[model samples]
Target: MIVPICSCYGQTEDGILSKHEKWEFVLEDTGDVLQIAIPLAAGLTTLFKKDYKGSKQFALSYATSLVVTHSLKRIIRKERPEDRNLFDAFPSGHTTSAFSGASFIQRRYGWKYGKWAYLGAAIVGVSRMEGPDGWHDIWDVLAGAAVGIGSTYLFTTPYEKQPVQVGFYSNGNDTYILSLKYEF
Candidate 1:
């Protein structure tokens, strides 16, 4: 299965290179997407109420995945399809990083946000294939994604805290008091 997928991606890479030079810009800009996803994922961590540990877990998982993927790239040192570059392309570093950040966002938020993050990750993966280097096969992207998602789940503690609600009420005299309650 992996071999066939890699072959298909190689074929697709040819078509992308032949058809679209403009895609190079898109490929380059995917770095900015990763920049944004990381911070946004961190911000979403606060929404889990008392799950500070979970927040740390999410952040750490993302960082660890990035390091692991990049290190593996150096070790494998597979040549890019274009041969213009000699850098390893066996498991896409860009795709791994993007998915790591995206998975962090998705785990902290809900599917609505997860869907958008995943879509952005897809774009990054496609951009890698479209780049001038023409590195990475479909299996590479898939493996990178699995590594990212798996690490995120493995590191993050499950959300087990009960929800707490805080409300503000104002009296006629313009005085306000906040009331707090725990649910479940």
Candidate 2:
């Protein structure tokens, strides 16, 4: 997917900072789309499963992340890495959105499914620090991720409920029926 975008910008060394300008551009655009897509996708998944509770949980987490991220950005008034004149750069909003969705997926579904979302979220973080035109520093990205994950942790729970399982266990000549329920 990235190969075509990289080739379009000609050579990477031609960039102002000798960084892959094409990669930076592609990453920035991709990250922008992903920030929205991830949350939408999570929402769709919940709808497909008919899990309204999970949907509400994810929405709350996402909303909390947005509020917290924007509040911090406004309060800190930190300058962007690329331009000191711009102030709302203390927390990368793109990273916050991406991580919020990713963490919600992990919290609701499970790691087996959420790992891919996390990988995409990590890419969004990288995009924020990719090139001369990068918008944020590591601190901003880290804080955004922390806020996202923290918010989700406060609201989300697993989609699958562990029900009591009644089964028979046999060892040698002994047989027993047991009921089990696993707790988080």
Candidate 3:
């Protein structure tokens, strides 16, 4: 149900790609770098912090993004923008992988890092678009971003709601301490 909405924004028929430009290859490599770096960073960070839940969340998010994105690409089996490739084109895997990493940083680490994380994410898609090979259309890139971010956002939850919460409240001269929770 939610999938359609995420994929709706950037799709189009008769899509085209841009001509090659200088220094654009760096953008493509940026996506490739993210695919390797995100998991390594998360693992090291989690180990240093001894945060078992955070590690679990990163692993789940990463795995879910790859599996879902690849599965859809195979199922849709569309073509590349220049038609050099005749399959695996509905969504961009690079874009998806990049977004997955960015979303993880944003969700777990904080938005401070999110700013850079998302810039890399967006760059991956744009780089593909700038290529002479015409690897993907804007719709493909957008759909890839949607899937990668969506899967993580859906699987990873806020840490604010703890299993047990303790708080204190004051009402005029009356002060009180309370704890409450409803887990689903």
**Candidate No. with top TM-score:** 2
Reference-based TM-score of each model:
0.66, 0.77, 0.69
Candidate 1 lDDT tens digits, 7-83: 21222433452333444645646744664564465547555465677667867887788778888789887776755
TM-score ranking from best candidate downward: 2, 3, 1
Q: After aligning candidate 3 to the native by TM-score, how far in Å is the CA of 42 from where it should be?
A: 3.6
Write model 3 residue lDDT over 45-145, tens digit each, in one string.
Answer: 66687777877887888888889888998898887765565788878888888788778777877888777878878877787787435578999999988
Between candidates 2 and 3, name the one with more favorable TM-score. Answer: 2
lDDT of 2: 0.84
Q: Which stretches of candidate 2 lie over 4 Å from their true place?
A: 1-20, 161-184
Error of 3 at 155 (Å): 1.9
Give the Cα error of residue 140 in candidate 2, in Å. 0.4
Model 2 TM-score, all chains together: 0.77
Clashing pairs in 1: none
Candidate 1 lDDT score at position 157: 49
Q: How far in Å is the alpha carbon of 15 misplaced in model 2?
A: 16
Worst 10 residues of 1 by lDDT: 2-11
